[model samples]
Target: MEINPAVTFKHDRSIMYAKRPKVLIVGAGLAGLTLGMLLHKADIPFEIYERAQEVKPLGSAMYFNSTTANFFKQCGIYEEFLAIGKYVSSIQVFNEVRGHEFSMDFEGQEAEFGANGYIVARPVMYDLLLRQIPRERIHLGKKVLTMDQGGNGVLLRFSDASEAEGDILVGADGAYSAVRQGLYAKLKKAKRLPSSDDLPLPFSTVCLVGQTRPLTAEEFSDIGLEQCQFRRTIGMEKMYGWATFTTAQNTVAYNVIQFLTDETSKQNDAFRNSEWGPEAAMAMCEQVKDFPIVSGDDKELTLGDLFEWSDKNHISKVMLEEKVFKTWYDCRTVLIGDACHKFSPSGGVGATNAMHDAIVLANRINGLPFHPIAEEIENAFREYKAERVEWVQKAFDSSKAFKTMTGQSFASKATRFVSKHMPAWLFQRIQAQTCANRPQVAFLPLHNDTGRIKPAPQPSLSVRAPVEAETPVAATTATATTTTTEVV
Candidate 1:
């Protein structure tokens, strides 16, 4: 089949392609699934392997901020997202005794960013993204045992002894990423891995999260409201805190966090293939079940009520690890999401940053020449890191700041005071920075920016702009497709 020469489309500036490189993505979480969708839109050949036997409602809720809204529009999923999520304008904060401390209002965020942020249950968000990819491309229960890259391509060995080969490997497999472990093992053997990369992901907090079954308006008075009711309470004497967000589904998503001491954090530094199971979730739930919620009603509503209304299987417990690795890629292998930087959930930017990582990495991969050499591949990876590392650090610091604000430490108390009294201009500036890094699929038709503040410059958007050919160009290989949109 020949593609029409007159058909206008974007073209890569790099080497001409005989075929697109095949990508093997480890993990079907937000980052990997997002990259898969972008690659598919770019007509790149790729497959995703998830270690889980099935995708579960593992996380509680995710906040869709301005950074990701436009990409959702580009992917044609913005409407669906809005349908399943509750529009959030502010986060109300409270002290341990339930006294209102202050509110972090995002009142003009929509006007400034051209998109409103939403809070959606994790399962609902996951299902929405999962539907964007072809069923056959996602392989469940296929855990990566080992991985290696050569001058020609990359190879993966699964726990089942099955093998797969691809031109690129992406480690979007979360905090205890096996792909990262394997890649670091190889790098360490060659003495190329940095000393910091050898250390475990230090975590200072543990979190239990879940979404309750849909409740009647009578059950949760806030459920009847059009806007999301997001409330967080910091423990006064206890070293724990809790939050609840009402979703569009009439379900309540909640999280309870246990702030650990330095000694406790060090002692609990360990990795697990299954981050949390039913037993562990249940155990944590029992500990925080008595925690009070700011559910507006005069009748005291505690976490116990939500826990009782939630599905036992849906609850999850996870460690909140904060780190941004210095090394992101080497040879044909690269990392994204928690694999590279694991952020605390305090800022609610973990998932957003993960998807942003997907956007940048996908843009880089789409620009690669077919069967690119190690140097070319490494160059692309370097660009990806350069574009993302600084932003990731910013997000890490932001998350840490928020986490500290809710802590019981003397520093945390000072942070809380400063946060409550923070100037409006400084607050607005920080909010702008949060929305400024919105990145979209560079190989696809770009979404027009509608926000008042121009987004921070995205290098990929300009460098990887799709070009229109004046004449007929050769089609891609059978396995790889080229995505094109007709000009109106």
Candidate 2:
């Protein structure tokens, strides 16, 4: 069915969506949620489907700086985030024996970037993103078993024997995304998929992460401080590493990473292939219980205390894989975040990069013409990739470097020595480059860049006039047979 373009106005923003393609997102993750919020703001029709019956707070905590702060302001949740986030002054790194090695100070970030660094519990951040959209739009327990897209439209078959069709399909799902699998299967059969994309994701690190229950000042003195207590401990002779952060909720979030050598990675093939759940998490907890935690007030603590205080059901153990797929989209199907690129958690930019993917993709999608065809949709996908691929590669490389620096290999020790002794001027130069690309929603009124250091150019930005009234203007420039189908 041929449909005319639609101009939907909400508040002060007006966006012209070419037929307003019904977006079917296959994951309600950070990337998916960020995309949904932008589409919602533009009055574009979209729905998110998650395989989990209920979303769990699996990861530990996430740090946010200028990279994503503007998007939070665009979503009108910046103030809320500030309220829940614990400001981070610096991240202190120590040796296995509690001797301070080095520190990454973020003291002047507020003045330089217009936003201070902050760390919040992953669950808290997830909840903040969840509340932006209407509850009815998110369909939980809808596991997508298969996906197919033709020249005209896209379709999804869920595990419950139900099906959904839309003009566009987004694979925002995680590393093992079913949507990606389906797309790759088709590409492989047609002899179009790249050989590297066909390989399984390789990994050298496994992580266990969780957030403890709220504690009193007596229980954890660091919780009383205004600044986030971020600490990292690198084992000297052991393969294990650990970190902890004090959050605004009077809770401590911790992560334990075990670097696996070539032999060890090969040895854990069975465990790596098995599904991860509470049982896997509990078993890992027992293994890393003895790892020491750096705390203020000279108090002694260990990973076991945090694990004990945390709900066992919330802790998660998963492999940290780093890969950027060569193929991101085909026809009406595309991907975002982990579905396309998976970065190690060492850089603390995995979630930030995921949301960045969503922002750029949404901007490109909003620029589609009044009556877009398969070619046009693919063009938008290509443009999105073109604009984001460079940044994604940079993030992947940065994350990998950090992962190597924290490993127990001899090369890791050398990298740490060089990093610890790096000149302050050179270090700041690298830091400046890393924080230079802060993208925002283009169709909306752009957030004023108040940072001293300007952000990198955003090629996907599409500035449009803001609507003046409450009623939305609908475009009716097509034939009488034109119809709009809303996804239920």
Candidate 3:
């Protein structure tokens, strides 16, 4: 495979040689795993610490837009991923009470952007990423207790009374990040912490997500073919909405979001800090048990029906928090993904943003000289933050706006009116403009020798060729070589 020269950085193979810094990453989620993959490609030593005993199917499902699809292609996992997901041709919006409907076609996106949006179960995606990296590098059940950084390096203390040191540390630990909290605490004691990092944006919406067993042909037909389409149904009020998507795995994933409009601090606290478990999730489902899941062809499937079809153990409920923090790094410590900027999941771009962070940050670090000093590492962190902040803020705002426009508010009504009345071509044009501005992985090779990292050979698995791959290659041999290299 030829590498694209445009994305490669030129550097002497051997100059000022020093031992490459080891990175200690907290959280083995998407962001952490991606960073590890990039570092592995660059021959940088790193380790990942995950609090969970093992990686499991925890979340409902995630969507990958063109931007994310391109990144996966670069990583050599696009074909495998494409085989697991269902390509979303269009998105349909309906109002149960108002009897309004609209559709946005995404089929043209494939021609313009190389791929359309695809949806897959969260676990399937996680497994694909996990398979690319060596299992020894990941440490499970390792909860990060605290971290301290000094002139030499960063020291991490784990809950199991173990300690480790690394040249740099990254906190990819999700919204309630312990690394972010630890860094903030240290800065606050020194009286240098910013006010914005003191608290996260308040959340008033609660969500329940679950996946149903594979639907039989008869069951699927009863709900209409629209059930197989990406669909969102708005409620009569501004505070409620639900979305459903059926994947290639034959499972149906659904999300129910209800916004609290009471405007009371108690109500906010109750929902935000609410304990979520199987019982709680089922209880919430009972509240709207009769709510329509999909209504068409004189047939209606309710939330209760979906819940009844899902395993109780797979259901989860939680609050949706949205915010972009003012600070992302301090000294040898930095943050990525939901640890810094969290989205409302309305636009389905949060995971994509996380993957983007991994690429940008890795590229910045890869640009540094071999065995860089602390100053050089800090400079890389600064550059990474500078490149990402604006884009992240934009995505954050867009997601919030999307959530609002799908509700029962005046804005939602206006949005619905335009969507229902607009021509399909106009919608496609608007979507094209949005995709044009979407952020892509930069400073990385895409086509030639410098573009991607090939992984070590693994056992054979069945996977189809990516839509973009003209000549199909065996899955086992196709992803066997590392495509990118770090200057040493």
Give the range of the ten consecutive residues with the poorest summed lDDT in model 3. Answer: 455-464
lDDT of 1 by residue, 1-488 (tens): 22122344454434454677889999999999999998888888999999989887767888987888889999999999989988899999998677899988888877899888899998889899999999999999998987868766788889998988888899999988999989899899999999999997777798898899999878888888889999999999989988999998889999998998877666445433336667878988888888888776765788999999999998988888788998899888999999999999999999999999999888878776555556566777877888888899999999999999888899999998998999999999989987899888887778988899988878766445234331222332211122211100
Better of 2 and 3 by TM-score: 2
The numbered model that scores best in lDDT is 1
RMSD after CA superposition, every candidate: 7.0, 6.7, 10.4
**Ten residues in sequence with the least summed lDDT for candidate 1:** 479-488
Compose the digit string of candidate 3's lDDT tens values, residues 1-488: 22121333433324434556789999999999988987887667899999889775766778886766666777788889888887787777877653548776677666665567888888778888888889999999999887888656788889999988888899998888889989999888988888877865667677888888888646654233532467788898546898888877777788888877776335546555423767778787888777776633444677787888888888888778888988898767899998999899887888888987887777666554444445556666776776677668878887887788678878878877876788877876666544553333344445322212221121111111122222212321223211111110
**How many steric overlaps are in each model, in order?**
6, 0, 11
- Model 2 residue runs over 4 Å out of place are 1-18, 273-275, 463-488
**Which residues of candidate 3, in runs, are more than 4 Å off?**
1-17, 97-100, 222-228, 263-268, 271-275, 295-298, 422-426, 437-445, 448-488
